[model samples]
Target: MSSILAHNLHLEFDFSYTSFPLVSLSIAFGVWLVWKTWKLITISRASLPLPPGPVPLPIIGNLHQMSVTDQSSTFLQWQEIFGDLVYVNIFGTPTLILNSYEDAKELLGVRSQIYSDRPRLSVAGELVGWNRSLVLGKFGERHRTMRRLLARSIGGKHAQSFRLHEEFAICTFLLNLLEKPRDLKLLLSQLTGSVVLDVAYGHQVKSGHDQLIFWFRRIVQDFYDATAVGSIIVDMIPALTYLHSYIPFTSFKKTVATWRAHLTETIEHPFSRVKEQLRNGIARTSYVAQHLSEGPLDFETEDALKYSSFNLYAGGMETLAVALSTFFFVVTKYPAIQQRAQQEIDNVTEGKRLPTSNDRERLPFVEAVMLEVLRWSPITPTSLPHRLEVEDIYKGYRIPQGAVVYSHPWAMSRDKRSYTSPHEFRPDRFLETPKEPDPRLFAFGFGRRICPGKHIADDTLFLAIALTLATCNVTKRVNEAGDLIEPIPQYTMGVVAHMAEFDFEITSRSDDAIQMLTAAHTQLGE
Candidate 1:
């Protein structure tokens, strides 16, 4: 019955040539329209302008515009010209500079999974074998394993366990300042190196002549030499790293080989010491000792232990010293700030005793001063480069995969948007109503790669600040002619920025402070 109805209604197909022309034209037009739309979208995404950067020159890219010595000021100028995110090409490698908090927070913090990888340092990391250490290690299982090991050893809650190490070291530091105050930098290095070595390995540092300290000094210098900007040709041309043995440049090759050897010795020295301590049944509580206390580990795990342990302390030592040095420099210049800090410590200790870790909560002003120093001159002015895992887009900008990224703590510290009177050294900003955000967040870093030793560094810095203020008065130095030697706030540029040497007088605040310092030193029994 349906067939009969269709037959009556005459539902006919339009397959004739006359109908084909219009149908074909319509289909072709629709296909063409679709192709055009897709082409526009693809072109837009591919050419998203790369976050607004200076025009790069051929081959050299933006390297000509960059001052290898002072990337901080250069990046600051770029931030002024092109907002927060500035992209540049270094040689053939793509790089993105993040000068603002929000941009860094979003990329390095919120989206860390894709932004947590460190850049490949050919000469330093590969040729000199520094890549095994957690700082320059590639992002992968090894890094994760190291992070877990570090977290268990000296992270957040566990950091309090090392209070004795910090206290003992600081006390020694105070005595050194009293006995040999002229070499402040050397004293500080000893202080930091001792504390870190004692905590990271079970190695107790001898005052001035510990072999481990010697190795540390040598290795850190080697690190600087191997990683110096544009100094090693291999870093820019990675392929040269393979030709080290055959390279005609004997001096460079020999230098790199020596650096590699020093790094190995430095990493192994403390680890061997810890093992020896364990074997002799006199192991001190430390990251290495604690791990070794567990049943024996396989080569991979033990290797991870050795390298991660070194990174744990070695990474913090120089940076902590720099932060403390900056603290002294600031106080020497602004005696009022130092006095205020002393007053705060006195309020906590009542001038009857040396300030201890327990007094940390009670000494807010001291904490503020530490924070201010970090903000004034971030130990690491530039964040270690983080390479992107995949190509991405942000704010209509296309960032290519493998584009190494660097966040500027120096820029963030001086950002008017986040700080008021950014140039001023105001500790009150951290304490006053509607307080400023703690600089530690960005200063330490952001995301998965944020400093694992941050907690320990914080605890260590606060104690050093508190103890020094409570016991000593840092003042301007006088020349041979008895003229005032004013300090100028200046810093050296490198991976760890250090305050330039300044003459300052550090002496006991009072007879009581001297007695207390004496008592603490005696308790050390050194």
Candidate 2:
């Protein structure tokens, strides 16, 4: 009875002392919370103050408005509505689309320092473990070092050195194409895969169904499957990462392990063999061997084994291969463009020899055709996502820290503000332009994170496009019912967008084509 009475008395005393103080503190905290929430809401609502777009919902934001999986359609839709500059969001992550050359040059080109950082993809980094991915890595010292190493080894003047092997591979591929015209896909894949493998690892990949070729295809398919949007939902909701694997919702642990296992395996074997060969005094002047000889400095053994090899396989195969695939589509659809390109090639080379990298400057029309091809079918439509590390202003808008910054190459390429007939494939736009904008470099990317293997990709593309035009006419065949049939423009979506696989028939333009190809392959050892 005494204890109960004391407790009641203590409670009465405590209430008398704390009631007013508690109410005051509550009022102060409530006001602070309201102010902070309003500030966040205002900042979140703020954009670069460009064109209008669908307002985003708080938290999830505009992810619902845009296509997260296949952003091309979203980009296209925004272009129609938002004009040159459009803004969207993904879970409160700001995605600014530069829809014109003016916008691309202004934001991605002019203000490059502010625009160069990559968005932090928690899922992509931790789940699939692309933390070391050269293309997807953040803009910083590591990106610079990797890019510098790659540029010295592959891009710029050093890039020209790989053309010998590249041209040789092209000739061999042409011979195989002539022999098996039905398997155009296989021919193109082998042609590109061989060059990338040879240059990156010094492995001589063959024309059809080789081990290296098989593994290359397997790895690319796996990587694509793993990185496809929503492949890892834990990437978006990071708190879920800490959940117990025994729980039904936990999937990241399994997904991450699978991706790491495959990625590590592909990277390690080639590096080990390359290292072994270098130690044996039989040094091949390949990218991996070059790094290996320097002995674990800029590129650690694990990095050499994993990241570098992955970059070559991923960047080299997907971007170049998709571009070529789309080129095939464009050539078949627009024969006039093909004929014009071929005519220029014939006028310059006089039909005497295959087009070489040296002949690039002379064949302006052909170069224009390549440019149009890249523009029409942007391999990486949305050039990798960027992040703002520091809080700054873009065109008088307070762009808060950790906002996602995107460089929309697809949007920019198709913008009516830049190209007159942005919808159509007209190579003459590049040739007849009052000012010939540099299209080749932009197709790669901007600033420090620009593609390292861009030169090799370009040279290979030049050789392939020229030779394919030189050797055969790519045309859509009439169906069994005598109707003109066109291959559907279906795309596989990711950070790198690729055209769906389709077949096309090829026939030699002249008997001279076969002879010229034969002579070239005979002289050029594959």
Candidate 3:
């Protein structure tokens, strides 16, 4: 009883005489609790309210309203209802959609350091092992270094060095198209994939059945399966990633294990081939060969080589094919666009010789058409998400740290403030004075995360569009009843949008065009 009395007296003395007291447990604990509460209150006052968005449901947030297939279109509708910065929460995960160029530019561009990081992709990265590649990997020294290496190889003018290979592929594509004009998708895939593979591993793809093409298709399908929005439970709730294996008697773990194995095979096979060719002193000049040739390689350097090579090929090939396919859709749907482009090409080439890389500057209208295609329908309508690194406030709206942010190129393309008649398909918009923002600026990406392979992809696309328009006429196919089968853009929108179901007729412009292709085939020794 005397000890208890003494303890109470000490607590009373501490509480009365000192703001900080180590002598009394109860008083010290109370002081610390008060300090923590004050800190939290201070932080709360500093941050403004979140950006406006549709009212979210409790606990589940906006998950019920999310669309798996048409996320961009849905976000676009929300942009109309809400403001440019639309905030959402999915199962406690915060998401912000920047529906205008200015918002995207201000946040994702001007403040790149705060917004450059990619969201953690639980299924695709952790389970399927794509985190080894830069696309799904975290941003850091490794990502920047790998991007530097890619920039050295193919970023800008270095892309011009691959013209011989590109021209060879284009010639083969044209020759095959002449024989089988209906094989649009097959021929275009071969063209884009072949160029990317050549640059990646020095593996030339001359046919549709090339082993690399099969590997490409496998990896692409696997990637889509792993990353399809609302498909993987762990991706939706990343905390569940740790518990995935313990989720009882399901083949989920085995499925992911198989996907992991396939990804390993796809990434390693070409790397092994390049090493073998180097050992025999017969290696071709390619990304892998060039990097391996420089004396010894540390583990980090070699790992960068392997994954960055895949990043280059995977990042570039699929989208180029889609963009090329969109070109066909655009020209077929609007013949006048094709005529203007063809006439421009004819004036440059004098209607005889094929347009080369040297003719790009002279073919302004062709470049405009290419720009318009990118703006008209961005393949990846909404960019891959960017994550905020720290809490920030913009325009009186607080953007929480770890919020997944997306810049909407689709909505930006249709902004009335930026483009006159935003819904119209006008290539001349690119040629006009005080030209609208170059879609290339936002199309490939923005800030530091922009595609390093943009130059090479642009070169290939310009050549293909110029050559195809110069040599052939794209028109709607006639049915068996001789009725014109008018084609509309039947887009099956997803992660990567495609006009996969459209049919159009491609035909040789004249006898001269056929002979030109024939001579090129002879030069190709095919």
Candidate 4:
């Protein structure tokens, strides 16, 4: 009986094993069906037309069509072929380029609630610890809080208090030009850095080589270099961040560690000094002082305030430096425009004194020239990237969530529909059509993410241009053969576009101009 039972059990096991193949086949068949369905769904979604763009290769996806150095021009060329909205992928990341003013306004401005978020910059923002910075921070409660604090501290009426700092900085620039004209670029950098320092922390920069200014300048340059599109591979392909430590000399982890250390010093050192001054009862009214007066804040809020206030120097200084450089480049390259601008300044001041922001209303031509400068060479050509928070469609084109949107101010400024002779640097164009939209609309940026320091920047540029033209004759450098060496207004390839180094001669317009600068310097006791 026991032998029979064992035989029966063996037979049952063999029978079950014989049927296993059928069950296996059924399971595999179900998996295949599910995979087929998923693939079809994916294909259907992908068939939705992305805005017209160059045919992309599998993984790179139009990366070959891009130039890391001149991305703005490349985007403009793509726009010519693809239309106002051009979609491309940077290493699997979807990017939307807005080449027209209307498109930019509709998407980045009008739809800001969903489009105001900043893209994650793995290398520049996260690795380098710049995520704390208001400019690079994500869109959230923290960003909103920082923006609100910044608006109260530096936007609109609050910005007016910085006009005196701008005036003083420009006055010093005028005097510096008289003594060391060859250092024009350095002087401009100092002027911008000094004004922002005074306004943000009530810290006066003693000279062009002030220790604080030096660190801030280095930090700004590095930040731009790190954040510029395509500068770091890890930024485009975030997964590569994991491999950063494994790479040899190409390790972004090591590079970012170094940058992070310096950035901490850059953001915290000055802020600590300001706090110390406040503790010692030697504080001056400034962004930091005002915020500190609000009482102690949580670590997160305090960090936000520090970074937000630092933005005055970080964002304002580099941009204004570049703008002032472009102004010099433009005026010197086109002497007739320079002459016209100088004539406007002369008329406004009547050669009696240095032009001030109080005379800004009367100096319409100078204002137009400033507008033209902003249009002709936008500092941040592709204003900072804005990311989408939700899926959206416009004009029958799909803009998926997480798409990085860039407003092409450089392209929009050159749009033929907006300005006649758009390529020409003509201030007269702005004067002719007072109703025409100013480039400042796009130059400073769009929506809630627009520059809060716009007022201070505008006032600083206006006064600097007015004072420089009123007191100095900016012209091309004369060669040994006595020929005028005209400057080619080539710009540096970065977010903050500055004119490449060029030779120029700046001289007092007349003895009266010299006297005016001298008197102003004496009044400031410089």
Candidate 5:
């Protein structure tokens, strides 16, 4: 039967070379087609106005070229290779990494409006409705309102009103660290959380293990981690979202829905509670209550409540935590810096009080330490993504619209053009007369999206560090093997950066230290 089938198939074919020539020609044409495509790509490359970069392959582009080493270091290395302004293709999307301070200033500063937009985080911002979050919103009316409200609530002059809370929060943090030295990270996170929560929702978290605080932070961390990670199959190849539910693997729809539901619940439940509390003749001066009463403004909508809460969670908490972590790591490593700051505090307040916002100007070292802490750890190295709203013509080249602009603080902070010893931790850099560290402003970010919580962050850090350093000395904890183990100064990756945890032992300082800190703490409240 098989032989009969082969015989019949052969009978259908003509064995003449004249007829076979057509098939040969077809094969040759296919090879010629591929060759022509290759040539076209090589020639087209010259015509395209490409930014400075290594050549990229078809489809994926330079996505695979990105190395996920320590994000800052990897970016620095890329800058060295591709020049200050490098273009890398991120899944066919053009990404601009500005390694120079001038380039960042030019793009994000001079071309402010054109480069101030954000990439569409459809899943987190749209799906979870995080557009209401201040940091995620597109540049427009809503963004202006959100930023203005935040600045009013937690920015400059308004932060002064919260000095009492800052004093209490720092004192609480110092006392906890002195008593239970092992739980440093937990205590620091909660201290910041308590202040922001009180500021936003009028809720006071007494401990790091508070259920509400724990759940809120957990959800926030999950959301941020998800936001940072790229799900290219769905993002680059978006049709996967419409896959049939009958298929066993439909996790994308479920995961996104579940996250959005979680966010909605987390954000809305607290607003209701605050409202209920307000109705009982217990009016609290929180951002949430203020917004609720004010109702809709030009920028305020019902969705604003949830997004504002998200901003409170993201902007308010992490900056404080990372700053404290940087302080701890620096103090543990450079005991001299800590001692110098302590001496300055002692001289100003006579070791009888902790430093306050009022004393921030007097204690130059305290201010310096805060600056150095931000510079040393340098959180959010890449800052946040900025999108080009219009084509930017700079340096005789055109930066086309739709480019993803990265304002790399990592590179900027370490630029030789900025600091003398950019890598080393030097508090004195801030004290120099002719030129102090040009404000170390990169840590917070730039333009309209610049962190509104910066003033609060500064106050919180100074008070916390001053109180902690004045009262107790941070040294390495002894391991079970009797060797002192210090925190390895490594960074965690993401849009935000943090010091990796290491066990350190905090010992109570002399009686004078405690007395001075207490006095300073008292002065802070006044």
Candidate 6:
């Protein structure tokens, strides 16, 4: 009996040991199967096609191909090579350029929920303190609040109240042109600055060298220069932003610091003055004074108000200045077009009065010319980089979260599908096909982030163009040797795309025109 029990126990032990090895092998095989499945899924995701683009280099990606001053033109060339949607990598950042209107409208407009966010501009927005400014603010509750306030203050009918400011400013500019034709660009800049100051802070800019104008102009110019693509290396290589403090005598850092200080002052100075005016019962109909009059505001609300006001001041002044300057440059080059515009203005107003907003609808040709000028040279070509807030697939390609997207208005303006003979500056194109999309739609921008000041911009530009053409004959500057030195149609490399400083002759078209401008300026008490 003892021998039989020992044999049975030994058999039980042998069976238990063999089952343990089989169990271990089965467990190992299960883990391997799971891992293989996971890896295949990962590979499938990685293999999803990205948008067509030029192959990037190892580390720098496509940074070498970008130009700091002329990124729009460069992107346009790439659009031709890679079709409408071109993907590029700047360092590790995936940049998607929307070259066509349909693509831009689809991504930035139709699906704005995912594409409304602004790119994190480490150099321009953060370092320069423009993140507080509405133009560069992130997509959030703060942005929404500021945008709503801005829309209420400067949009639609509220924009029309400021038309008097524009009319007076343009009339003053006309007189300045008569006295100092060579200073046409300077006069236009001062006029825009004056109008913006009055609208934003109720402060009249009395001189070209007004301290406020000078500081704001410097701030705007430097901000554009500092924030421009490829302007600061740290923007492309984000790690370097933290390292900036460790390096001694960093010029860019110093510049940014100075800019931040100036920017703060730009926002606070006029606002404080307006508030003081409100407190003293001498407040005017300025944006700040009007808001302050509503009652005391909390810190956050007040802060939003301050930055929103700065947005109006900066955006209104700089963009209008650039657009009006571009008009002068383009019309000076194309005399026949200028003559045609002047004829239209003459027929509309009969040289008895300066052009006003009431005349805008009747002056379709004049409006078309304004549209053409905007299309010919879009002020903000890429319309400030937008960021994808979530992962999205567009046209069978994955657009990962945080990818920088650009709506290339410059390229869209020259689209053959949209405009016939797109490169040529033809105003009649708008009149030809009522169905054809106005370039202004793309020029202003797309989606929820379209320039909030578009109404003000449109009104200001129209008045400037009509009144200037009505009163003045812009011709090439004649040298002492009696030769007409035609101004070169060149543009500066910046966010606003200003026409390069060029010489032109500005003379009153007729005595009646000068009388009309003088009478209008006198009526406005300027």
Full-model lDDT for every candidate: 0.86, 0.74, 0.84, 0.84, 0.74, 0.84
lDDT for 422 (candidate 5): 85
Poorest stretch of ten by lDDT in candidate 4: 228-237
Q: Distance (Å) between predicted and true CA of 12, model 3?
A: 42
Clash statistics: count for each candidate: 0, 2, 0, 0, 11, 0
The lDDT-based order of candidates, best leading, equals 1, 4, 3, 6, 5, 2
Better TM-score candidate (2, 4): 4
Candidate 5 C-alpha lDDT tens digits along 164-263: 7777777777767777887878888889888888778777677667866776786676567456545433556555556765565557667777777777
- Once fitted onto the true fold, the runs of candidate 3 whose alpha carbons sit more than 4 angstroms away are 1-47, 238-246, 521-526
The TM-score of predicted model 1 comes to 0.90
Top of the candidates by TM-score = 1
Question: lDDT by residue for model 1 over 430-526, one digit each (tens)?
Answer: 9988899789989888898989999889999998988888888889999999998999888788787888898988888888888887788678645
TM-score each candidate: 0.90, 0.84, 0.89, 0.88, 0.85, 0.88
Off by over 4 Å in 4: 1-48, 228-231, 236-250
What TM value does model 5 have? Answer: 0.85
Residue 120's lDDT within candidate 4 is 86
How accurate locally is residue 471 in candidate 6, as Cα lDDT from 0 to 100? 87
Residues 1-526 of candidate 3: C-alpha lDDT, one tens digit per residue: 9999999999998787885454587777889999999999668746568889988999989988988788887898899899799999987889999988888888888999989898878878888888878887788887887898888888788898887677778878887876787888888889988888888888888677998878877888888888875435667766665564667633466777888888898899999999999999988778788888887888997898899998777788778988999898889889999998899888888977888889989988899999998888887888888889988888988888899999988898888888888777899998999888788877888776788888888899888888889888889888899998887776778767887657778889999987886786567443
Residue 70, candidate 6: Cα error in Å is 1.0
Question: Distance (Å) between predicted and true CA of 478, model 2?
Answer: 2.4
Off by over 4 Å in 6: 1-46, 228-231, 236-251
Per-residue lDDT for 264-312 in model 2, tens only?
6777677677878888987567887876677566445346345766587
Q: Flag the better candidate by lDDT, 2 or 3.
A: 3
lDDT of 6 by residue, 422-486 (tens): 87888898888564578778977888888878888898899989988888889888899999888
lDDT of 5: 0.74
User: Candidate 2 or 5, higher TM-score?
Assistant: 5
